[model samples]
Target: MPSHRPRRLVAALVACSAALLLAACAPTVALNPAADANDPRCADVIVHLPDTVADKTKRETNAQATGAWGDPAVVLLRCGVAPIGPTAKPCITVNGIDWVLENDPASPSLRYITFGRIPATEVVIAHGKNGVTDAAVLPALADAIGAIPQQKQQKCLDTSDVTSPTGTPTAAPPATSTPTPTPTPTN
Candidate 1:
């Protein structure tokens, strides 16, 4: 019994050390939540996030509804951002979700914010690392981001859908038909 106790203690110590080492390898990512971070819809988006995105494994984040991937965090996602209206910034639809591109000339990262979705989501992808591209990163997160429903009035549109100056849709004029000549009365 004495010999068995020593063996059991040694096994337990080994397991604890291995766990600590693994935990140390993955550090918690610090992120600031959006203004509407407390929105319940954000929870839905967070839960649906994939374990791996763009070949980068998901990292634990300190803030609610926030996600980070890759050792240096090439992709970062935050839900519950302020929803945006129609904008000139390019908007693209991926996997049934629409994302509005936000470009900053000086920044190396590409930022995308979900358009038309209530409690919008924002994803930032830093380029020149992990061979990540907008094509790959956006689609990977589309499923989780799609959890937020898009508001019809705020949806993205092409030039053809642009409204007139008065803000109403430009519709074609009503068709006019030639009237038949009236019969002349006899004098």
Candidate 2:
């Protein structure tokens, strides 16, 4: 009986050591929940999240309305964030959606926010091997972001789009091309 007890004790210690080692090997991602995390639009986006981002595998995170990617979590996205108002950030339209790039020199990663989107979304990525991570991520995330209804203030006007200040779309001007007449040869 004494010999059996010692054997059990030794086995238990070995199991505990192995468990601790495995836990340490796992990746960690720490992020905070957005204030508007409970928005239904955010829930829809979360459910539709991609399995990966920028070639890095998506990993589970503790933050609400958030998604993570990479073992060390190179990319992090948070939905339902407060709308950005009149920032000097450079904005660009992608896949019919406008995005604002907030380039902070003090930060190691770049930040991107969907322009004119309600319950706005923000993505931060550690600069990847290729210089452009936003180009890879924004396209994949466009539809999900577009699902959220846009506020009137959030609408972007493309120069190609013909619309009045009253918000009604107007017909675009006809293309102007001069008709070239061929001269008849005299016999």
- Which model scores highest in lDDT? 1
- Across 49-129, the per-residue lDDT of candidate 2 in tens digits comes to 888777777787888889988877778889988888766567777787787878873566888887777789998878745
Worst lDDT 10-window in candidate 2 = 155-164
In the range 1-187, model 1's lDDT, one tens digit per residue, is 2568888899999999999999887888899999999899999999999999888889999999899998889899999899888788888888888888889734678999998898999999988745477887888888888888878667678888886686768899988798879999999
Query: Cα deviation of 120 in candidate 2 (Å)?
Result: 0.8
Model 1 TM-score, 2 decimals: 0.77
In order of appearance, the predictions have TM-scores of: 0.77, 0.65
Candidate 2 residue-wise lDDT at 4: 88
Assess candidate 2 and give its lDDT: 0.79
